[model samples]
Target: MENYFLGLEAVHPSCLAKIITGDKLPKKAIIWEFTNEIKPIDLYCYLQVKYGSPNGLQNFLRNDSSDNLIHWEWSLAGQFGIVSIQGHNFRTEVHLIGEHDGKGLTLEDFIQQIKADFKNHGKSMKSVRVELEKWTRFLNPYHRINSVVAKNIKSLNSLDVKVDEDRELVKFHEENLPKLEENWKYVRDKYDNAIGITFGLRSMLPVLAESFINLIIFVLAKPEIKKNERLLQNTIRQQIDIRVQSLHLNCIGFTRPIDYTDDVCKKFHTLMNERNDLLHGNVEVNKLKIGEVYFKGKVPVFVGYEDMWQSAMGISLSSVKYNTIFDDHAVVTNFIEFILDHLSKDLKEQVQYIMTNSELGYNPANGRLGSLFSDNIADFRVSVNEA
Candidate 1:
């Protein structure tokens, strides 16, 4: 395993005066952070055009295998440094390595010189804008899917009431009930369709919640857990409840575990049970009752029957109501908020910003100014470059 150290904070253009005071360059690599307006790719392209290929004295080499928009190397004063833009969160960094003969010049002067060079020669790169637009298009479908689900649930509830009313009318008119088989069949068909939608939505809710929870883990898991592929896989494979509880320990390092008594946790546990019952084919039989009917010209008829209705199997689809779907969705949101509440102020702010705006790209206005770094410096170079 390669040893790693925390690199010096990258001097942002705005903080140069206060931070970069001395001529002595940092012993460790200095990570320079940039905004979306000026991405590392934009800088790379400009340098490529100005300095040609990376083979020359002003070497500029791009890692074609890297998923990051800006995973490249540029030689400044004969020393190679990495310039990378993280794909997951669009956090840009230029890791300055080794030393330069700045003589009496301070680090501030060197940064100013680089900015001047870019200002004089660099052209705007469309990569950042294009990537943001692509993400926007990707997210649009999810919004439409959620809207359709809500609309279908509303329709299902309305149809459910009608089916119940039809059943009641058929029971009261027992003599004509046999003759109304076609009407009953038609009603059953409509009921089946509406109820099928609810079942499908119910099954999907747990899946969506689980996926989101896994996403949070992926984003916020401790460095030790993330770096060990086997450990990460094991953690993910654990029960959903375990994974949820582990978030407090692994990410936030809280000695106290997440409170299962909380409403959010209660809802999440219910969703997990539902998902398990569905996947494991746990059939729960529900009894349905019909009232006794009296005839006008004959002895009163009492009709009673035993029926097996499994909610998970859609035998009792009515059991999975709109509120169930709503509650399942609410639990995911609530659980996210619940976890956020436990995080430190800085971590909570960063995590919230990343969760909300990562799809769109990083926006400094929403939270902390610079890129969020993991514990391992090598991770800064490699993990962020992966898709």
Candidate 2:
């Protein structure tokens, strides 16, 4: 059994100074020694080629999507010492492989599958010129998916509003918004600002996240096909990722069951963007201020804790089950069960083994009461004859 420590770190400026000699002096830095078994892909290099940073490393090979403009920051401890990487979309798979998928899917791999499918099956909106236009230049954009709200849109038809009339689409948006609005009351009335104050609301966050993931999966699921659904779905994924990252939020689980089409994904993304704006202190919309948070890019907005608590409860009602439970309180319990489900069966086995055998073995501080916890020592260990 082994213990994995996950915590923040403090860096010594003298140690970092040598590495960043020609660069700016370090003031506020979050540096740590990298000790994970898995090797890290150079995010700056990845971004320079993948995103085309205005100033990339010298003699670095350019990647296919060099036209993309993404920026973010990441740090690691290489063999030499500390490595700090700041740029956009510089993410490597924190998603462990073989948790749910025996073979984890990479963006490159997904793209290859789409290209193959396109070459073979094809879709209603396939064309060479369209193919060139539809390809992704960057995974992360500074403005984020929500930033494009100010972009040109000839009509909602492009957005797949499902209705022929523009007014009907707007009407539908107005009608469904009450759910998100009502949720605010549930969360805001409860906890004040605390680290985990909105932890429960993270579940609802995935509702939006999964919707976006569905869009990416939609594109990757297809072959070289250029379906109208492709870009729309990508929009959903892009918007959701940006929102999640911008809010500095994390998900408790990921469960999206969308068929994955471009148009469907776009619709959900659009809905989430509007919701984020209204919920995060936005005042432009009539009566929006009575309750809600407004989203301002680069400006961190925190939702009322009470609104999220209720949404968390609502999620439980929708998920979790043990003899078909009912009642509102049950929703939270079910949601907990659901978030635990985020750990795949394989990962759960790993966690269980680590918890029981490792030094960190179910810290008394974090586990359930000893009485409530099963005395499985004899069950999993020596099979004892009952006295």
Q: Can you write out model 1's per-residue Cα lDDT over 1-387, one digit (the tens) per residue?
A: 011111222233223322234444343345555556444555555555544333221113333432334444333332222222222235545444434223232334434555556655544433333432221112322223445555766776666545446555444376756766676566567767766777677776666566656656665677787767898898889888888778776664343567877888888788777777766777665323223466768866545442322222234544556336556666766776786677677777766655443232223233213223321223244322211
- Quantify all predictions' global Cα lDDT against the true fold: 0.51, 0.31
Query: Which candidate leads the pack in TM-score?
Result: 1
Model 2 lDDT tens row, 203-285: 23324234333422322233222244564344344554453332211221233322223343344445445445535646564
Worst 10 residues of 1 by lDDT: 1-10
- Candidate 2 whole-model C-alpha lDDT, 0 to 1: 0.31
Q: What is the C-alpha RMSD of each candidate to the true structure, in Å?
A: 17.3, 27.4
Give the runs in model 2 whose Cα sits over 4 Å from its true position.
1-190, 193-196, 199-207, 210-212, 215-220, 225-274, 278-281, 289-387
